[model samples]
Target: MLARMTGALRFSPAEIAGFAILAAVVFLVLPLALDTFRLNLAGKYLTYAFVAVGLVLCWGAGGILSLGQGVFFGLGGYCMAMFLKLEASTPAATRIQSTPGIPDFMDWNQLTALPWWWEPFHSLAFSLVAVVAVPVALAWIIGLAMFRRRVGGVYFAIITQSLAAILTILVIGQQGFTGGVNGITDLRTLLGWDIRTDAAKEILYFVNGALLFACLLLARFILKSKLGRVLVAMRDQEDRVRFSGYDVAQFKMFIFCAGAAFAGVGGAMFTLQVGFMSPTLVGIVPSIEMVIFCAVGGRLSILGAVYGTLLVNWAKTTFSESFPELWLLGLGALFIGVVMAFPNGLAGLYADHVEPRIRALLAWLGVRGAMPAPVAGGAAREMAPARSVAGGRQSGRSLQARGGASPEPGP
Candidate 1:
């Protein structure tokens, strides 16, 4: 039993407990506290949480800081938006348009027919598949090209940032097909069910939470696996990892693609919850903001990433609402503070200070299972031999001094 316990204890119980608590809060407490409108807003923020979680793995563990996650996010979002836009732009609904069967923005821009790129999105199944698939495929190409060529560090970041800028400019330039700066808006339904209703928002909120937790679990599983350790090893010592006969580039590629997938799914959820996908969200600023979410949460901690995203976004919304002009200044100060003070983020602070204090308090209060049980067999073996030897020595000294034979032990 003790051996089995030791084996099972290889996995960290503290991490599991943290995830369980996070699940409870996300699934129970928040839904109960926030109203429909606020919950829907939470769902929107949760979409960004998805991006943050991915960043935790890619940037924190894999040490790949992608400044173009918004591109993947936008691709996934636009795929979903295209499907929704098509459904919303049916002939009957667009009877007033010169192009009766096209999106409003396209019609307004003098497009007489739906573009070839927009046609595939008419199928809901294809749209759903493309949401994750498109972003992942793009990431695969980029990762393969960059990692194989040994392009990383600040250079890789700059390249990704440039990609984001280019994509944003393209979106804004191609107003007819891409919806320009206004973006794909006025999304109405999903499979004939109205997503604009309060009940739908409530349902979507729960669904978003479920998906977020699922992603969290997937991330945890990966992090606990051998591959996760390899990622960390690679991040810290890329040359050593490569010298150890491991295909380091493949590992980097896989993580990059995984991060892109997460961001893509998040973008789809964002479109569903918020009813819009815009070029504003598909640019360098939003990409950097996503990184900040992970940074603020503690990049190494997955649960911290989620909380960090929610906290930062909440602060952003509140500050923007209250003191619109000071919001940027406040954000700048926050970034500076996080960099200078909490380099490891909230998780590091909790792990270093709060968790140890909690354990001490629990111990003082005589709480059971405050920590995992110690491995018993080795300690017991060492102590038992010492006791036997000490007893023999003491008995020998006493018997010699007394000049009497020792009695046999009782059964």
Candidate 2:
């Protein structure tokens, strides 16, 4: 049992190397190369990566495509933003406002008392829990309604997109309660710590990186477990799995909720790093862009999501600065090119093209057992062992091991 558990939890050496390389790039290289401003921008990009990683598990692994992830992200950000805004809206701080101790927007909109729903956010603990719980709760409801009924594919995607649009309109319409079009801005501190400083931003960046790794590891564990296999099977053969007596709807709901939880956490971190949560980020456009991030990063690869987010955002910043009018067109073209030319995205490219060369080089260098079997998108493929015929390896081998050429054993 212990050995079985260990094997289940084990990661391939290539995955370990990937993790180390990513850590170095995020924690060491980027900080050394970029100034504080650029580093902060990268930090912001990392927050979106949270959503992309979730998409990998939900869309890539489970075949559940949600285009309304921004709703969860925005909810999480709003939870944190409410806390920060309240802390900044002390009676003394907002003394000049018509209603002291209330958010400026509330006071401007003639709200004399804090809304009952917003009251709970004043407690940091409650706010923290709400950041994740709120989104998951919403996901749970949606999953129950749709997944249980087997409403999925493009129809489900359209529903989620509609949710994003609805949420954006609700937030904008309820200005007094939600801070409206401007969002919950002017956020100053977090539990008495000023979050607007460069030093503070740097600290938050490292914290975000640490949290990202934690999420990645959690995702890895999920994908490596039996549950992960079930998800993949359900993705490829949902009716088969359902007919085999598994609770397909339950599994789908769980993974969807998990994705929402991850997105919520990202939204909270985004609020801290950017010091604001706006409707612009919680709308249809941003939601669609989030999907593009996952696709560009290799939706099947968790780590690739982070790299993709950084790459796309960096390109957006660079191109928009130069050709503001054509940036949208370029972005559309880039997405089209990626979808058409590289359906599996960067991770697929690396696995198909780059990993083999690296393995050959290691083999040439007489490195024995240093390079473990390669994984595609951080998950080990299910390969069959070579069959023995006449006391020798032959016949009945898997497609990956045809012609007596056995694939490398996975960890």
Best by lDDT: 2
Clashing pairs in 2: none
lDDT values, one for every candidate: 0.83, 0.87
Model 1 residue 86 distance off true place after TM-score fit, in angstroms: 0.5
Instruction: Give the per-residue lDDT of model 1 (tens digit) for 192-253.
Output: 99999999989998888998988987887777567887887787667778778899999999
Which 10-residue window of candidate 2 scores lowest in summed lDDT?
382-391
- Work out the TM-score per prediction: 0.88, 0.91
Choose the strongest candidate by TM-score. Answer: 2
Considering summed lDDT, which 10 consecutive residues are worst modelled in model 1?
A: 376-385
